[model samples]
Target: MLNYRNALRVGTASCLEETSVDVSYEDGSPDDDDVPRRAIVAVLPPDQETRILMLTTYLNLARCASHVGRNKDAVVCATLAAGIAQHDEHTDHLITAKILRSRAHLAQNHLKQALRDSAAATELAPSDHKSVQLLARDVERAKRAALRANKQLAKEVSTWVQSAQSKFAEQGGNEADCAQQ
Candidate 1:
């Protein structure tokens, strides 16, 4: 009884839901950064290929954004994670996405956004849980640091702008003078 579009959507959704991740930490420390989630996802059945792929893809994209200092790229990865959760329904992925989304917000100094996402991740996370709890704590700490960072940058930029305005005023609002000094 499903319409063509609805069927396609459902099928695609299920297809994507098959993907997953590895969440194990070695001695409470991640053994590898490249595919930190590998250990967790690897334990799942071979039939869950999509879940594995999605998890890896999201993690890689997030790492890439960090390496490149690209907040937009990070946001895109987070968005993909949010989408994956629609069909995946696994608690882990949802928590991971929330953490990733929080990272994106933190990178851009969006404190409120970061706080909300990180808090969600921490709350929904399992007790005696895996990766989610640690990431949530990390993000929460980072959120506080980000707030300070934003305020510091705002102060610096404001000071610079104010100094420039004062210097320009001394020169009778001369554009050329402002540009020179």
Candidate 2:
């Protein structure tokens, strides 16, 4: 399994390193700032000589995957990149990886996990860094999404409760009896 996973990572990194593609957001809205305008590929030489190069490759692959809506793959790649960066104590790369994973989680509507990652990224970056600014935007977006989801869930539950109450009332059951049931 380790060998297969490594092979997959190396293969994907090779392709991403060799490729340069324009990236647009999944939605037409302008607020899609999670991904770069162009895929961040091949910042280092293709030699893949150092840990930083590997980290870049993984980050680029994850970004491309997220751009293309392969969010699950993006999450895996970003998590791997985050692990590498954390191990190497590379704050910038770790921040990028966390933001990418947060984006993937947001895309999948895992709002709680998304919020956690975005917050973590925000905390990791220096206050004046561009990454922190970007993370601020993402954290706001995630909060809004969570709020909307919570409102929707409350509405649904309220509707269900109302329907149940109406049915019980029609069947001549009092609120107290229904509560006991």
Clashes of 2: 0
Backbone clash pairs for candidate 2 read none
Per-residue error for 148 in candidate 1, Å, reads: 7.3
- Each model's number of backbone clashes? 12, 0
lDDT of 1 by residue, 1-181 (tens): 0012111111211111223322233124332222222122122223567655876687678768866888777866665555455345666776777777777787787778777887787788867566666666777688678778889999999899889878888878875667686
Give the lowest summed-lDDT range of ten residues in model 2.
Answer: 1-10
Give the winner by lDDT. 2
lDDT of 2 by residue, 62-114 (tens): 99999999999898888768766765678989999998999898889887778
Candidate 2 residue 181 C-alpha distance from true site, Å? 3.7
